[model samples]
Target: MFFKSSKINEFRLWGLLFTLFGMGLMILGTSGIVFWGQAGKWFAGVFMVIGMIAMLLSVGVYFWAGMLSTSAVILICPECNRHTKILGKTDRCMYCKTKLTLDPNEATDLDEGITEKA
Candidate 1:
C-alpha cells in the first residue's frame, strides 16, 4: 500500500515528518560548533535558519490539515462500519483501509485498480 491512509492522517503524517526533519536540521546546526570551533557559528546560523523555515512549513501544514479536518465530511465506512472523515471526492477508510469515494466513476476505477493489483 503506497498510500493507505485517510487523507487527514496522511496530512498529519507529512506534518510530523516535516517536524522531525526540522528538528534534525536544528540539531545538526548546533553540532557545527563541535566540528569547527568558532568558525561553526556561521554554519550553525545558516542551518538554524533553514531549520526554522522547515518548522514553519510544518506548522502551516498542520494548520491546514486541522482546518480541512474540521470541514471534512464524516461518514461510516462500509467495510469497518466505523466513523471516518472524507477530505475530497475520494479517500480511504481509516480503520479498514478500504478505498472510498463519493464519485461513482472513481469508485469503479479504484475497484478495477485493486482487482488488477490483486
Candidate 2:
C-alpha cells in the first residue's frame, strides 16, 4: 500500500469541488428566487437537487479514500524502496524514485529497470 500526496490532493480537490457545488444547489433551492421567471425556476430547483446529491457522493468518496489509505500495505522498493504505499493501477517506488507500473506488459514497455515478478 502506497500513499502519494498527489493522488490525495487530487481526491481532496474533487471532494471540495463537489461539496461546494452541492452547497450552492442547496442554497438556491432554499432561496426559491428564480432568475428567469417560471421556466428558469424549475432549472434552479433541479440544480439544487443535483448539488445535494453530488455533495453526498463526494462525502462517501472521501470516506472511502480515507479507509483505503489506512488499509493499504506498505512496501520498500528494491530499487528506490523508501517506504511507499501502492494503490490501484500503478505506483512509483518512493526511495530511489523509480516509476512503478501495475501491469507487467506496461511496466516492461515503460522501462527496463522495472521487474514484474509479482
> Best candidate, TM-score-wise?
1
Q: Per-residue lDDT for 1-118 in model 2, tens only?
A: 3344435445656778888888988777755555566666777778777987999988987987677778665667667547776666666653454566656766655253565533
Off by over 4 Å in 1: 108-118
Which residues of candidate 2, in runs, are more than 4 Å off? 1-9, 24-43, 75-83, 93-98, 101-118
Q: In lDDT terms, how accurate is model 1?
A: 0.89
Top-lDDT candidate index: 1
Measured with C-alpha atoms, the lDDT of residue 16 in candidate 1 is: 92
Evaluate model 1: give its TM-score: 0.85
How well does each candidate superpose onto the true structure, as a TM-score?
0.85, 0.50
Minimum summed lDDT over a 10-residue window in model 1 is located at 104-113
The per-residue C-alpha lDDT of model 1 at residue 70 equals 96
